[model samples]
Target chain A: MNRVFITGMGVISAIGNSVAENQLGLLHGTCGITKGTRLSTRYSGLLPFGEIAANDEALKEILSVTDPGVTRTTLLALHACKEAIADAGLTGAQLLSPDTAFIGATTVGGMCLMDELYNDANNPANNSAFAPFYDCASVNMYLQKYYRLSGIVNTINTACSSSANAIMYGARLLRNGLANRVIVGGVDSLSRFTINGFNALHILSDEHCAPFDKDRKGLNLGEGAAFLVLEKEADTNGKKVYAALSGYCNSNDAYHPSSLSENGDGPFLAMNGALKMAGLGSTEIDFINAHGTGTENNDEVESRAMIRLFEEPPAFASTKSNTGHTLGASGAIEAVYSVLNLVNQEVYPALHFKEPILATRLTPVQVHTKKQVRHVMSNSFGFGGNCSSLIFSKAG
Target chain B: MFFIHQTSCISPQETFSNVKMDLLHVSVHNKLLAIEPAYTGVAVGVLRRMGKASRIGMGTAMRLIQEGAAPDGLIIGTANGGMEESIRFLKQIIEYHEDMLAPGSFVQSTANAIATQLSMLTKNKGYNITHVHKGLAFENAVIDTAMLLMENPGNTYLLGGVDEIASYNYIIEHTAGWYKKEYTSNQDLYKRNSAGTIAGEGAAMFLVNNKKEQAIAELTALTTLHSTDKELISGQLKAFLKKNVPSGESINLFLTGENGDARDADLVASCESAFGNETTVARFKHMCGEYPTASAFALWLACYLPIDQPLPEHMLKKQGTTNKNRTVLIYNYHKNVQHSFMLVTKFK
Candidate 1:
């Protein structure tokens, strides 16, 4: 079996615009959660979000995209994709290589352009530019067309676990000899559609979220994008390898639409399956990057699941406390964070935590501390009981 | 080879359960819907919250699983998912100015809902994924399933595609000239030259496994091309068939995606000469209508007609009916850009 290796990574989130800045923020326990400033929403002032401070115009200027019809989702995806390819030191020909696959995951593609969609849907004009950008695969298609990539290009939308599945799929392509290198990740931007959707579900937090805390209010919606360039171990002889993608698995709770079962069956199975694939035991998992959505249901259910799997449970923390729950981007974002954990030999603290949940009696790592991290399991659960767990190991 | 262990499809066609229908019954309106069954054993709480695609898709998936197809992974390719819910949510956004949007519609609006809903129903916590790439969506899922099966030989998958037509979207596509100007019944779709085909929606799922004992059909080859060059298309089609169907044994039947569109007519015209006069040629879109993932219905028909029963007289656009409909070739070219060729052979 071919071993999948993460050669390069790029991320743009509320906490930072690059992987270096995000690492600094994580080390200092800086929380990016705050009231929304850029989104044109009714609850922008009342609800807190991990919104990228830069506006759409700033992002466009940064990406040098002149296409006005390109949505923020596309812009964010472009930013991360460019950085990932650059970080991988991929040549121009490699970008257009048939052996290079690009898989992007997202729940909100051009749908983030909600206002434009409304006008186009009402009138049905053939000249409507927004119509072409409305499909969920629009952003990925834009990347493929601009780069002229002929490799296997795909888009995955399993809600929060979306990018995790994308990463897994990319690895499978490499394992199956379909591609030699895969640029796999996800991107989403703060928009009225996502905000309103989360608000309507009554899971939007008014203040900063505290994952696994007794008084955890709800999730603070965030927007960002992250991309990781994965190559097989054989292909990375001299290239800088960050970590090995040890194991990944996706599972569904089959319990509810918006919430998980009280027993946390989906999370448990995904985590267990990923570890089994990685050929590791619970005791071997040194640290866990818990999904920790900070919602009342997610924190309790996840904590109970952790307890069930890891008797005493490993030293785990939710970076959502630092970066806010990034929806579809959370999994890949956390995967990067877990890689950073193995590389830097440190554990980032979960912010705003005071007491443990009554049922599970589990508390996250309260403060930033140095640790000997080996295999880190990153969990991301999403709507419709979609749960995914990824295990990353230290590269030799 | 990836074999079809079991399958189910919810289409406007009279394919309820394992029953049979002899002929096509064209609907009065352009938009045709799947004749859904009464969903039983599903939790009422879950049912009420599901979008239309979720209900129909889960029902189809459950029926296949009941045939003892235990899938370790769920992969779905839905081009337009939960259209009604997305439309309602978008309308509310326009109506209420982005505030007070109903949570139900928003929850079900994501493209991932199709596969997630099925996984939730089965409680089979496995590899669940969804793809949305317009015309090439279902083919993408199938390609991925084949790759996954190749990587892990014994592993099976529930790979399928689902799409729905919402009224708002119907007006958008219909008014934009994606549908025909004249109201032609689906059965008579090919009689008149038109700009667009009638719109339809359906959900089709197949349990793809490596077990030859339970194989319904062998998915010999599935290839997707993104180029529009007709020369490349014909060349690739020949090479694809040569690899799967052999040189001497040409295709027994040609199940073409020949919707009423004139452009499509020009594309399918090559098949007439390419396969010679001995191959039976037919179309399934007349019954299911045209959509991005509409080729999925063609796959469902290929699963049945060649292996189980004969095609209806109305469906046989060209009569090259042979004694044994063993080698079935499914070809679809969408919007002149995406082309997919699938070769399915009867399991003997």
Candidate 2:
């Protein structure tokens, strides 16, 4: 059996632009959620968001991408991919090898430029360059084309669980002997398409999101990207191994398109299946990074799910409180956060939680604490009832 | 080994499990609309609210309900997923000035909605994923499902690829010169020798199981290449067929993605030359039109075309196929970028 280990992690969220910065923000309990300024939405003034501080042009400048017409989603992905490969110490030759795979996920591909697409679609004579990037696979395709990566590259769009599935699929690439190394993650930018859609669903929070809270109103929309480099344990000789991705599973609630079953059958099955895959008992999981989207239905259902899985419930927190719900990138971002805990043997607390949901009566870790974090679980549930869970363990 | 126990396709042609010769002509129009089945089972209320892409996918997935236990994993691939709903929702937001917007269209606009709907209908709470890579979408899903089956044997898997053709998407492709400048019929798709190919949409579902007894055709290998060089594609094809194809016993049938575009002639010619004259060549894109997942439709076609079925005059390129059909290969590529290969053998 091939043992997959996480060699590196890179993330850029509302909380921070790099892994270290993000970790510092997590430690200080700093929240990046605020009224949106970057996205061009009419409800931006009312809705809180964990939006990236930089615009597309500035982000491209930071990434040294001079090519015109590149979308913000692609820029965010490239930034994260660069950091991940560099952190993994992957050389240019290694990246060009057929043994390397790149799997990316994104909910807001080029739809971030919905206006451009609409205009271009309405007037074909416009010859809009953004039209080429309107497809959902644009970000991954751009990454693959830019890096000249010819391996088993794929783009996943299972809504929020998109990146978690990407990571899981990347691990399978190594486990199946299809590739020696894989860079897996996802990116999603704040787009009117999603904002209006989520707003229409009445789940966009007007204030800072309070995950796992009884009085939580809704979720703060966010935009970001995160990536992790995974390789076989045997292959990482003297490489900085962060953690072991021991378990991963994706299950669907099949009950609703945007909402989970009241009982969270999807999250339950995903969490249980992940633990089963890791060959660990629920008690062994020291902490959990809950999906807690801060939505009324999500918080309560996730709380009930935790109670059903953990006898006493682990010290869990929804990092979304800090970065809002990053959607497709949340899974990978939280996966990186979970690994940081395993590496440093500490856990961060969920923010803005005044009281627990009455049903589960469960409260998340409310303060930053240090402990011997052995195994951590992260959950990402997306629209279409697509639920995914991943368990990462401490590496020697 | 992964055997396709059951399969269904909602294609432009009347390709629902079995192929129909009717409506099997080249589509002159840019869009080749799918001919859907009147799927029973699953409530009409639930089906009515779903998007076209979701409905097509669910219809295909529902056909495999009686194959066995609930699938351990469900994977779907789509290049342009739920676009009708997406466009509708976006249009509503812009048209209504972002006021009084309904969430129904937004909820159904996601790429994985079909997978979620199927899971809910079947109560199968297992691994579910959706791959949305362009051109390589279906191959990506198949690769994931196949690799998972190798790791977890005996676990039945439902793998599918779905896409839809919308007016705006058609226009987008047309503007990009992805559609023919002059209208060409499906039969004359190969003869058009134009700059663009026709657009089509459909869904293909395969119940992949490890058991050979419950198999229609044993899938030997599925490989994809991300390169534009025809020589590289030809070289890789040779290596792939060498590993999967037996010595001396050449492939009896070749299903090529020869959507009539003079630009792709080099690739089509390269593939034709790679397989010796002994291999009988056939093409599928003309019948179903051209889409990212058209190769999946071609795959469904390859599964049954070798069972002593008379080849259509338009489908055949070279005759003289061996009577003892054993191996069939499906090769397809888009523009010059992504190339995919699938080998299916006659289930003995």
Candidate 3:
């Protein structure tokens, strides 16, 4: 089996529009969660969000997107993917090679245009221009077509863990000799569809999320896109290797559709399985990027899972405090952050964490500290008990 | 190669168990909705509220378990999952102005709801995932299942594909000319050289493992292509067959996806020509209608067909009697964009 390495990474979240900008925010401990100004929804002014600073028109202008009915989801995905491709120095020929594949994940999909879809669905006479881009596969299909990619292409939608599973699937493809390299990641643009959907569940935080904090209320919905160029070690000889993707595992809780078990059985098994796959002991992990959606159930459950996994749980933090919950994009976005931690040998503070949860009595990394970070384990648990843990180690 | 230990389906045809191929008849309809099976072992309260996709998916899993197929993992593919609930939630949000709305529809609107529901019901919490690519969704899940079996040689996987026709999505597709202007009976689906094919929905589940013992069929090869050029797809399929099949081995049964759309006639014919003239060729979309994951239905049919018996008369596009029906090759394309090929053989 061939080892997989991250040759390039790109992200555009509420924190920043590029990798450098995002790294700066992380280093400076600048939280991106704020009152929404870009998204046009009833709750835009009522609730907090990690809304990208630029509006749709501005994003289109920057990306040179001229397609009339293109959803913002596609634009954000294109922006991040373009940077990742450029950063990896992948030419059009490399992208078009049948050896390279694209795996995209998304929860919102074309519902980014929720109002328009509703209108078109209700009116028969209206020619639905966006109909072609509404399916979960549409974003990846658009990317494949845009790049003229002739390789294996697919999309995964495991909700919050969608992108994490995308990364795992890509690695397996490379290891199995199905593809030489894979551009794997996810994108989700905030829309009324998810906003109202999450609102109905009463998990949307009225204030900025406080992950792992005692008084944490709920999660704030965010939108962004992140992509990582994963190449087998043999193919990435001369490339700039960000980190080696050493381990990944996907386990289901089988307890509930939207909630984890009281014992965090899914999370514990996922983290434990990933460690076993990497052939590493629990203590070998230097840091952890917790899923920590800031909801009462997630924070507490994740905390308990950590305490169950390690003799002394490694220093951990939740960047959802920085970017809100990007939903489908959270896994990849946090993955990029986890890789950054290994590359920089630094850890960022979880934003609004005041006190540790009473049950686990675990306090997250509260200050930006330069540490000897080696192997960083990133956890992403989604609705439907889909729990995944990915371990990224320093590339030697 | 992965062995199909068991199969279940809730489709337009009565294919859930012991499919009577001889008694089957051609049906007529634009919307080929699945003929739901009895939820014999399912809880009544949960069955009352489950969506069509979930009911059929969970029902098939329950049936397999009762027959002694204990899958350690669950994976599924759907082009549009829980779309009915998604539309309902959106409509409610619009009507209520996003206030005091129920959470049930919203919770079920996610694409992975069916797979998660199966996990919750079965408590088989090993590896779970959902693939939502359009035409290749089911194929992607199949690919994952193959990899998982190779990685852990002893494990069994419950793999499935599911999709349902929701009015909101159906209307949007209809307005976009994705369906025939006139209602064409599925029995007459190929008889007419029309603009569009009928819309259909179904769920097909399989218990697959690496062990060949007691296996019904073996999946030898699977490939997906993303291209609009028919020539390119044909060349790729030829190459795929050359790489996977041994020399001089003949394909006995060739299943083709011809959804009765006039524009796809040339492409469909071109793909069919990739096989030898002696290979028995048949089409399936007429029976199941046309949906993204309808190829799952094709696969289910491939496993159930007897090696010695001839295919039902209505399903034959071209009949050849030279070879026993030991090998089945399924070729399907969606809207001339995504195409896939699968090779399945009777397990020795």
Compared with the true structure, all predictions reach lDDT values of 0.83, 0.86, 0.88
Task: Rank the candidate models, highest TM-score first.
Answer: 3, 2, 1
Q: Candidate 2: where are CA atoms >4 Å away?
A: B22-28, B321-324
Candidate 3: stretches off by over 4 Å: B23-29
What is the docking quality class of candidate 1?
medium
For all the predictions, what are the DockQ values? 0.62, 0.81, 0.83
- For residue A296, what is the lDDT in candidate 1? 94
Instruction: For each candidate, give its TM-score against the true structure.
Output: 0.94, 0.98, 0.98
TM-score: model 3 vs. ground truth: 0.98
lDDT string for model 1 (A1-396, tens) is 779999999998888999998999999998998985576778878889898888889988998989757888888888888888899998889888878888889888888877777777677754466666766788888898788786788888888898998898899889888899999999887778778888888888898998999988899988899999999999999999999999987788978778999989999999998999999989999999999989999999998898889888999999999888888788888988999999999999999999999989998998889989999999989887888899999988
Best by lDDT: 3
Each prediction's RMSD to truth: 2.5, 1.5, 1.3
Q: Where is the poorest 10-residue window by lDDT in model 2 chain A?
A: A36-45
Report the number of the highest-DockQ candidate.
Answer: 3
What digit string (tens of lDDT, one per residue) describes model 3 on residues A1-396?
678999989999999999999999998888898886565678878899988988889988998889877788998999999999998888888998999999999998898887788888888797567877877788998898889998889999999999999999999989888899999999999888889888888898899899999999899988999999999999887779999999999999989888899989999999999999999999999999999999989999999999899958999999998898999999999999999999999999889888888888999999999989989999999999999999999988
